[model samples]
Target: MEVGFLGLGIMGKAMSMNLLKNGFKVTVWNRTLSKCNELVAHGASIGKTPAEVINKCKVTIAMLSDPAAALSVVLDKDGVLEQICGGKGYIDMSTVDPETSCKINEAITSKGGQFLEAPVSGSKQPAETGQLVILAAGDKALYEAAIPAFDILGKKSFFLGQVGNGAKMKLVVNMIMGSMMNAFSEGLTLADRSGLNPRDLLDVLDLGAIANPMFKGKGPAMLQNNYSPAFPLKHQQKDMRLALALGDENSVPMPVAAASNEAFKKARSMGLGDMDFSAVFETLKVLKHSS
Candidate 1:
């Protein structure tokens, strides 16, 4: 099946490369034309716009940054809306609010287009390695049709059954992820301040039931102050903010998520916004010295 990919930022680039490597015909479009260079060189077709991508493929997946960008690519001139119609499938893998997903779903289905909100649960490595966990919802038929593509892109894919479910599921998962990162940051800094090697602490965590790939993977680099943008800190803050809004809308108490959101905001204020989300560890170091 011909696949169209919109957006070529960190996640999008990694993902489209995986699809191309797997022998899929992929047509890609990015806001910045230069961002498509690597993929274009790797035997992927280059699309001038979202509409062009949709026109060239039966299934088009977009990994946009946030709600506004998500909305823009679909609603703007030369957008997905222009080409979406019967027999076409649109999958959005962006982490956004449930309401936003619903809005997109409505727009696509109104024109007889199949829509699926398929947000992911992993960062750069997982995306590149095709190990992401996909939370998909919307049309079941579309989900079934996209399974071949999803299998190549993610380690697991869950069909959550409805337009908003996938979006809600993604937020809940990311909320916990953000909260855990905050706890991890605190533990790392506390260990350092107490004259214990944080690396040793990482070993201890790894030996316990709390062991997770995130800590094991991000730990060493974080200790070396390598805050590369696998997943930008600003985007993490955006997810935290959206997750908190989801909590408020549902009357669910989310104190931990709220606190984590503030920590992310503080990290952004420290000019770590463009760095990896792990840069929140930097914010922890700043707080340690400030106090």
Candidate 2:
């Protein structure tokens, strides 16, 4: 299969690389052209603009960082809208709000292009290993058409109903994830301050009903103060903020998510935004010691 991939950030790079490794011919684009070099070295072609990529491939997938970048690449000069036409499918797997996803969908469909919002759930390792879960919606035909590629990018893909469903599902998932991470950080910090080994806490948690891959994967790393950007703190905070807005739109209260957002904000204020979301551990640790 031949396809176009946009945005060569951490997630996008791994996803596009997987496509190449799986024997799909891939064309890539990034605002910073140099980011394309590594993928190019691995036999992927480059498109200087979003239009060029869309022009050359029947299916184009975008894994941009946020809503603004997502909009710019599709609405700006030489953007996707410039070349999108009937039978051309665009799958946006960026983690933006439902409204943003709908906006992109409307624009694409108006231009006779098929659109799908396909935000993903999973971090760097899952993305690298194609173990990510994909939440997809809009244009069921496009979802079915892109399955071959989605099969390569995600371990599971859910076809939600419409344009905004995928985005909402992604936000809800990330909100819960952020809340859990905050709770985990607090538990670890409390354990350490009480003269208990945080590692033991992790071990106990692992053997319990609440055990999850995230805790198992990130627990030891958090205890070691390893905050390398698997899923950056800033992005987590962004998802929290978006999810809170979603709650407001639905008249649902999300106090825990709100509290988690505050912790993420504090972490970002402490210059840990670029680190792993688990770096919230540092923020909690500091407050405990200061008290």
Candidate 3:
């Protein structure tokens, strides 16, 4: 099937590259046209707008920054819904709340287009390597129909029932991730203040049951004070807040997630939003020194 990809940010570019590398016919569009240049050279077609993409492809995938951007592209004046028709498929890989996903699904289904939420679990490197885990939700037939494309973009894909479940799953996963990162930041700061080497602390953690791929992956970067944006702090904060909101709506108290949200809020308040989430370490460091 011909696929159109929208949004060419860090993860989006990597995912689009994977699709191209796997020999899928992909047409791409980005708000910043320059972001599509490299993909264009790699034999991916570039489109000027979402309408043009939907016009040319059977499946259109979006990996935008947030719900607002996703809504803008899918519901805008010349957006996807404007051009989508029966037999066309729209899969959103952006991390958004379930409510937003449901709204988008409604718009697409009303227009006779199939909709799926297939938010991913992984960062840029995983996306580039096709190691992303896709959490998909939509009509069963539609999920099956998109498997070929999903296989090219990810290592594994799960069909989790109807639209919105994928987004809900993403929020839950990110809530734990946000909390873990904050806890690790505090631990690292405590170790350093006790005159214990950060590297040694990382090594110890790696050997313990508390160790996870997140710490193993981010620990070195944190130790070296490299805050490059594998996942931006602001986005992580957004996900945590969304997760907290979900908890509130369901009447399920997520005290740890709530606390993590506050940490990310503080991090953003300190102008660390654009940095890698591991920059939460810097927040902990500042607090430690002040104390």
| Candidate 2 TM-score over all chains jointly | 0.99
Worst-scoring 10-residue span by lDDT in model 1: 281-290
Candidate that scores best on lDDT? 2
Q: Residue by residue across 1-291, what tens digits does model 3's lDDT show?
A: 678999999899999999998889899999999999999999999989999999999888999999999999999987998899898989999999999999999999999999999999998789989999999999777789889988988889999998889999999999999999988988887788889998898899999988789999999988888999988999999999899989989999898888888989998999999999888888787777798
lDDT tens per residue, model 2, 1-291: 899999988899999999999999999999999999999999999999999999999999999989999999999999999999998999999999998999999999999999999999998988999999999999999999999988998999999998899999999999999999999999998898899999999999999999999999999988788988999999999999999999999999999999999999999999998999999888887887788
How close is every model to the real structure, measured as TM-score? 0.98, 0.99, 0.98
Best by TM-score: 2
Clashes of each: 0, 0, 0
Ranking by lDDT: 2, 1, 3
| Candidate 2 ranges with C-alpha deviation above 4 Å | none
**Candidate 2, residue 224: lDDT:** 82
Pairwise lDDT winner, candidates 1 and 2: 2
